[model samples]
Target: MRILVTGGAGFIGGHLAERFVIDGHDVVVLDNFDPFYDTRIKAHTVERCRERAAGGDGSYRLVEGDVRDADVVAELVEEVDYVYHQAAQAGVRPSVEDPRKYDDVNVDGTLNVLDAARDTGIERVVLASSSSVYGKPRYLPYDEDHPTTPVSPYGASKLAAERYACSYSEVYDLPAVALRYFTVYGPRMRPNMAISNFVSRCLDAESPVVYGDGTQTRDFTYVEDVVEANVTLLAEDAADGEAVNVGSTDNIEIRTLAEEIRDQLAPDLTLEYEERHDADADHTHADISKANDLIGYEPTTTIREGVWKFTEWYRNDRDWYEPLVLNS
Candidate 1:
């Protein structure tokens, strides 16, 4: 199948693109190479995907453009069998200061992608939603039925984009599925995220900062499982109009996560506590039963295992982590 993955140059997007490409599918990546962290990292992600595809039977192409560009999105949609809408302004704390930019990219940008898919006769679209859309879950193990009272603009925008996609599915008969991703972590994870920050600080033998006593809990999902879910969603016939949670059922506190990383990287490094960022949720545990039943999705990496994997990647893969000076 021919697949077009927006934000294919991003951490999660790049991983998903490689999965499709390795499966002998024609893959086209649409990315703006946004300066979210460093354009160099995004460029490296694209390069990795190209290299992966080059040695395989599949083909890979990169479309350097924004998801907000209607003409570009429309043109790309016309050439693909499926659309993986993963592009957006993704940082939570940053969104608190720049809500409009998040809205423009996450909300308006999504609408443009949906429009392109609708106009171009693409049958299926897999959207990359976030667990932040659930806000502070009133209950443990957040399910698809959980109320979406997003706390940050970033979460709100992702929820808004999901709604827009659902609306398009209803109004335009565009087959679509929104996968609400939990905390995704792995080798190419974004540097601004907790795992990357902690790893970098540890590598530099500096104390890593923790916010709000670091008690917040999260269900960290691995990149491979996330990519697998996307592939399953793209191929399944019953995925349309469904919003499923994709995550490992295991939940760990932020403090636990930091400790794990510290143990794996540099146990000598201490932690500095700071006030919690308002945009962060207290706890997030995805009830992935829906994903399991619908698409046979199951997370394969444990937090301890994943932490080790990430540490190894950081040490070995020079192509992934060159931008961060974790301790300021």
Candidate 2:
């Protein structure tokens, strides 16, 4: 199979591209190497993909392009069996500052992917949606039917993208599924996320900052499981025109997460609390029953175990992860 992963240089995309290569699928990674973080991480991802393909029957190609370019996206879609659209401008606060950029990258960019996939007759298109679309949870463990009242532009963009995928599937008979990811965390994750910030601060012998009195809870899904969810959709057609939640079995409080990472890396450091950022969700927990029933998906890693794995990976890659901003 020939697979195309947009934003394949980023964390989850990188991991997914590598896995596809290992599975002996010829893979093409489409990315613009957006300097949201250091571009070195993306270079490293491409290197890892090369390593995966070197001794296998698979091939890897990295195309330096933007998804907003319809011509580039069309050409790439024509050569692939499946499309995993992971490219986007990610972050709540940043999107609040610049909503139009978010719209251009997340909404318009997604339209390009879906349009190309429709024209090329791709097997399936898996969109990377976010739990942020649920807004301040109406109830615990948000279901797929939860009303999407996103407070931030980032969340609104994701909701728009996912809905477009669903609409494409329905109107154009294009096979597509949108997975609403919940606080995904693992090696090489976005440096501005909560887990990364906590781990980085703890490693530097500084207090792990907690926002909003440390009571906010998040369902931190492991990257591997998120990858599995996408891979499962490659062969399953029952979920076409649907949006499903991809998340862990449980939620952990921000304070608890900070404490756990601190205990693992730097027990001497205490936690620090700051006022919550504007447009941030109060809490998020996903009801993945739709994913389970539709695609037989299940989260395999717990938060505690995942935190350990992330800390270990960060320790090794600490030298290269040059995050642009601190206290994100």
Q: TM-score for all predictions? A: 0.96, 0.97
Model 1 stretches with alpha carbons more than 4 Å out: 318-328
lDDT of 1 by residue, 19-80 (tens): 88889999999999887777767777778888888899889999899988888998899999
For candidate 1, what is the TM-score? 0.96
Clashing pairs in 1: none
* Native-to-model Cα distance after best TM-score fit, residue 228 in candidate 2, in Å: 0.7
lDDT tens digits, residue span 176-288, model 2: 99999998988877777888898888777889989998888888899999999988987998899999999996898899989988998899898988999878777888898
List runs of model 2 lying over 4 Å from the truth.
Answer: 322-328
The number of the candidate with the highest TM-score is 2
Error of 1 at 34 (Å): 1.1
Return the lDDT, model 2, position 63: 97
